[model samples]
Target: MNRAVIVAAKRTPIGKVGGILKDFEPDMLASFVIESLLHETKVSKEEINDVILGNVVGPGGNIARLAALTAGLPYHVPGVTVDRQCGSGLEAVNLAARLVQAGAGDIYLAGGVESTSRAPWKVEKPTSLYREAPHIFTRARFSTEEIGDPEMGEAAENVAEKYNISKDKQDLYSLKSHQKAVKAMESGRYLEELVPVHLLTRTGEKMVIAEDECPRKNTTIEKLSKLKPVFRENGTVTAGNACPINDGAALVLIMSERKCRELGLVPKLCFIDSAAAGVDPNFLGIGPVPAVTKLLNRTGLSMIDIDLVEFNEAFASQVLASLQLLNIPEEKVNVSGGALALGHPYGASGAVLVTRLMIEMKQKKARYGLATLGIGGGLGLASLFERIEE
Candidate 1:
């Protein structure tokens, strides 16, 4: 297998649903990122072997193709889209790494994009008796009735109950997430990976959005604890502890070592290993345990070797439980905060994590970094990256 290296990774500021980015299409947002990457890296679009994107709730078309064309890339560049729900973005990166390893391609552009605001209402099959517009939120995209899929929040509730995680602990974690995020935002630690973009308003107004839109400056544990449980009456998960629906896009330029040398491009991070795992749908939040453990075992490395970890904050309960199962110190995970504070743009968050992790690794001069996310329907995805230069 050929070694794959990441040349650059970047993401748009995650916008809350109905926020600054509500009007932008996911494909258009992705194209903007693609164009920014090409211009920043000076990499010719023709050199790209493929453009693979991870997307969900975008009207179910070829998002990659749309993004590529919108970015004005040559028509010959093959484009592919992968849908793994929340893990789609990182899955796309993993697929690109594997492609390089398998000698299938030398250079690839991969990432994820999502626009919850633009998600259309779906319709179910018509019936003689009655028919109404299907609720996309109610529909289980991952499994059918026989498979018994549960909503993400409901799964988080199951995790909290199964692991005996307390409401206090969940609220505490949620508070930490916001505090870290606010601190990072104030210090501008997130600036390195952010790509400023213009957002259009309903009344023909334009705003330049440059930072994540979900962090609350006045977040406190007390405030978090006071919020009522949203998933269930007695559930530990609350709106304050859960990731907000969001809009955003993220991408990375992946290339083989030889390709990097050929193009005179510096390798920022080396893709070392990745793994995906599954768990029961009810406890889907625990999916990261097997996925991350498998990756560490295969790499013969310990969580101790990882200087930073980006575990998606799908919910405070889910992340807290996964951290407990992995026995990793809280300080080592999401040091700059997570989805709880930044918002979850679903399909785009995985790649956003990778982009954030790599940037932090450089700033902290870390040796190894890991990015991982748990998906809907019992799936977990993880990837390990090493700093290749500086």
Candidate 2:
């Protein structure tokens, strides 16, 4: 297989739901990031062979194709939209790498976008099984097992109970996440990859949302301790410890090493390996344990050799559990903070983390970085990148 290399990766500043970026639609937000990447890298739109987008909510549309068209790319450029829940963006990136490695495409764009503020409240439809047996639909609220369940928060609480993660530990981890995020923002370490998002205000005024809005700079452990659990009255997961609803878009340019050199583009990093794994749906948050272990074992590398790690913070308890199970060093993980502080934009989270990891690796002069995320449906995805010398 040909080595796939990342030429550039960038993301819009993550905005809280109903916050700075609420005015823009998901596709529009995704297009802005795609256009920014093209302009920043000076890469021609015609060079891209495909565009893959990940999205979790809203009416089904060819989001990838729409984003490319909106960004002024050729209509003929092939596009695909994928949904792996929180891992969608990373899955898109992984697919793009496979395409390049397989010699099917020389250049591709892969990423994800979500507008939780505008997420549609979809109504459950009668399942085929229900239709076949009309009496069943009347007897039960819904025919599908998928639709009759509780929200993700409840599922997270279930994981907490199963893993025996304590509420205090979760709160401590959540507090630490905010602290590290605030530190990173103060240090201006995220400026390289974060593109300022421009949007229209309610009064028809223009504004820019440049900084991550989820991180509570003033958050204290004492304040976190006082918060009540949201999913269950006595559950461990709380609003302060769980990922906030957010809006954002993120993308990366992937191409074969030979193709990048031919186009005179500097290779920022070469994709070394990628993997995905599955776990019990009820304990979806723990999916990353097996995923990262598989990737490390496949590549013959140990956790200590990894210079940087970006693990999505779905919930503080889940993040801590995954880290403990995987035996990852606490200091090296989420050096810029994870989704708990940065905001998880569902489909956009995986790509956002990948872009952030790349920027951190460049700044730290690190050789290797890993971007990983736990999905909502018992799935985990991970990608390994090796910094290429300029």
> Which of the numbered candidates is closest to the native, going by highest lDDT?
1
Worst 10 residues of 2 by lDDT: 135-144
Each model's lDDT comes to 0.89, 0.86
Q: Root-mean-square deviation of each candidate, in angstroms?
A: 1.7, 3.8
Poorest lDDT segment (10 consecutive residues) of candidate 1: 128-137
Please report how far candidate 1 places residue 182 from its true position, in Å: 1.3
Among residues 3 or more apart in sequence or in different chains, the pairs in candidate 1 whose N, CA or C atoms overlap within 3 Å are none
Model 1, stretches more than 4 Å misplaced?
A: 129-137, 144-147, 200-206
Candidate 1 per-residue lDDT over residues 6-47, each given as its tens digit: 999989999999887888888888988899889898999898
TM per candidate comes to 0.96, 0.92
Error of 2 at 290 (Å): 1.1
* Model 2, span 135-243: residue lDDT tens: 3221112113663343577778887887788999999998898999999999998888888887677799888788988889899999999999998988989999999
Steric clashes per prediction? 0, 0
> Alpha carbon lDDT of residue 383, candidate 2?
88
